[model samples]
Target chain A: MSAVMAESCLTRNEWICGEYLRTRSEELTDATVEHVTITLVAIALALLVAFPLALLARRWRLAAGPILSLTTVLYTVPSLAMYALLLPVFGISVSVVVCGLVLYSLTILVRNIMTGLDSVPDEAREAARGMGYGCARLLFGVELPLALPSLMAGVRIATVSAVSLTTVGAIVDHGGLGNLIYTGMDSYFKAQVLTASVLCVLLAIAADVLLLGAQRLLTPWTRAGRRAGRRRTAGIPRDSVMDAPGTVV
Target chain B: MGVLPDTWTWLTTAEHWSGDGGVWARLSEHLYLTGVCLALACAIALPLAMWLGHGGGRRFGGALAINISNAGRAVPTFAVLVLLSLGPLGDHGDLPTIVALVLFAVPPLLTNAYVGLSEADKDVVEAARGMGMSRRQLLARVEVPLAFPLIMTGVRTAAVQVVATATLAALAAGGGLGRIITAGFATYDTAQVVAGAVVVAVLALLVEGVLALAQRLFDPGHHRRRALAAAPATAVPARTAP
Candidate 1:
């Protein structure tokens, strides 16, 4: 059975080597879209869980160690093992992929978010409390903005890795570039595999750059010094306060 | 409960532990792939990173090399494996899988080593130099020992990741515990898949635990307080903005 499959795949080498993408533009586009959707959804879901968890850890200092270690354990579970663990429960689909990717993102996301919040000036927090700002208002109006760079750094790491990780979901028939990769591997279709793999890599790089752009746009004070100069009075004496958050996590 | 008993049954079966695709075979294959890939990555990345860290003149160049290598993380190991197996590397044996895993391991190895050496205490380095030490002596006697903890942390991180990711070798027709999962999937055996996953997870944790112990035993600067501070950051690729 394996020999026959390899032989059949070998037969497609001519067109696969020459005009693979042109011949299969539709498949490529669909896979690309699926890849993007999986990545975006996973990061979004990770953020939703990570934000509150990070805040909880911040509010209760003792909770930080256990929570971070739990996420680290989650992060350490290999991606393939993670998928298998999820598959029995979630069934073979996008949910399994998303759940696993979100789990992987949590360690970085929570750590960065916590770090960001930790870097908030104690004086600033006291001032916010003195001004009668509630917890929610203080978090959103002051703490979150100051925390933007670290949070965005985490988001960038999560987003880029999630893009690459989406390819692993092909086993569960999630219909992404991974599908093309696995199919190409099974059938030995060189062009199909190369195209899909390259696109997966490119997608990860592109997602990273896009997130960097979003970070720059959202945190304009990092780029514009006047706003930074103003914030310096109320900010923690940290060096990265004025820099872009593109630091690799 | 159903899955656990079924997984135990699958694991306990003598046949499952023998043959070309048996548990023992797959476990050894997984280890071989991880061992070779990690060795190659260390060979290639360690010297280069050490040189860059020790030289310290072209800080920009060293940072660039580290960053470019780290970008390797963004490229999924699976994609790289598929590309190599189906493309120029040829869909043959474990060559492509080795190449892909090695590439995946390099970034962390390179980054941590570079950061560890370059970030060594300036006072210590200056004192070494003042004591009539050559550059090599300083690196060998002072900097490398000082930097050992972070360097080993990088190795631990890479080893665990490689062990986990090398499971993909089975997808590319290479050998590993992943074959069990892949074969299980082929046969529609969820129990087998669950068992395979359990084995892989256990293997990963075991390797991680062993490395953690090895690090503590060999680390020159193994203060409990510093270890506590460094543990979380080292566990992940923490390039938090300084």
Candidate 2:
């Protein structure tokens, strides 16, 4: 252990070390692009599949149980193990990484979309139906809009987790920031590892924050309702209000 | 499949299970890494989350802690492991890996425990307080007990995650089942890699199953629900509210 420490410490001392100068910014940029591509593609595919599945589950309550259980089981499979399992079929390709990531995102996405759809107020549905709105029209116009907040939260979670999980795909050379980390580990390049790891974390945070902003921008009423909720629940204590129905936060 | 027989041969061979880098040794190392990190995380997170849930109120600090931990979920485990292992914390054997895994484990454990306690029926809590229970008593006897299922769920989630992730320890020169997979990759031995993955998958499933069973056993309310569902006559109660 001491030898290990001595080697690394000698390799890259702190207190404003010049290790950062050793890293290639252009390589970091390329890695960032790859990371974003993998994350976006996986999330998009998961969302596409999840929306329809969520609708089906919402349409049939019994189906919801089985579908959710299946997804949860899939979700429990470790990222590395899943990737390894897929290796036999996909053979270290981008498809394997994206497929594994999409599977991971599905449970969260489907559950959230279903819950969001469930949370659409009944009176709004009644109003839509009374106005001769067809099921499809109501879902597109009324139900989906109201479900935006929860759906956005789910998307934020799915996207961020996808970004993180993409790092694991580096083992297969999926061309992401993980590649940097892997190569760094192989060569014992401390600068390369630190740069890549920090960038991955930063990218995740940036994506999460961006999604949060987008959710706020899209759902004005949620923010308004939250303020109104705060005013109405002012007299009550904190924990009690937390349990209140329809409390956004 | 072509891979299965080869994987079986690799798994069953005594050579694969014997030696410093063998499955048994590696599995023990993996378990040790998981066990230590998980214990450390639970010790730190459980009480803090429970306290925050039971009495810390809805302060900004508590909310901030939960939010930061949730964001921790977004940070890739591999990246953290790599960074820690190559940085100042590097070369400390499994210390870097444990730190990374512990950070990863804390978010779910903390969130679930807090959310579970908060979601415990308010009416039940009121009743407990009405029965002359002190604040501590109310938390311990009523809230924590009520929150057992979700808390156990958190533990199960964290345990499975830790077990699966402990594989990365090999990348940092720390011992674990991951070494088998990595070595297989190095040698282009698909069977060994597949076998290592199978072992990990099975380990994760075992942890999940054990924790789930423990949750059900510890939480009498879950048993009561099972009993109620099992007996149809008792379930409906033979009475009409109408």
What TM-score would every model get versus the actual structure? 0.87, 0.86
- Where does model 1 exceed 4 Å of error? A1-18, A225-249, B56-60, B223-242
Looking at model 1, residue B36 earns an lDDT score of 90
lDDT of 1 at B109: 79
For residues A89-132, could you state the per-residue lDDT of candidate 1 as single tens digits?
88877899989888988888998888888888777888998999
**A1-249: candidate 2 lDDT, tens digit per residue:** 877656543355442334354446778888899999999999999999999999998777689899998887777777777778787778879988899888888888898888788878788988999999998999999999998977887887778778888888876898499898888887877767777777887888899889989989988888877887876633322221121111000
How accurate locally, in lDDT, is each candidate?
A: 0.79, 0.77
Candidate 1 backbone clash number: 0
- Model 1, B124-174: lDDT tens digits are 999999999998999999999988977887788889878877887777777
Tens digit of lDDT per residue, candidate 2, span B18-111? Answer: 9878888888888888899899999988888877777755554356445755576666778677777877787676789888888888876887
Worst 10 residues of 2 chain B by lDDT: B233-242
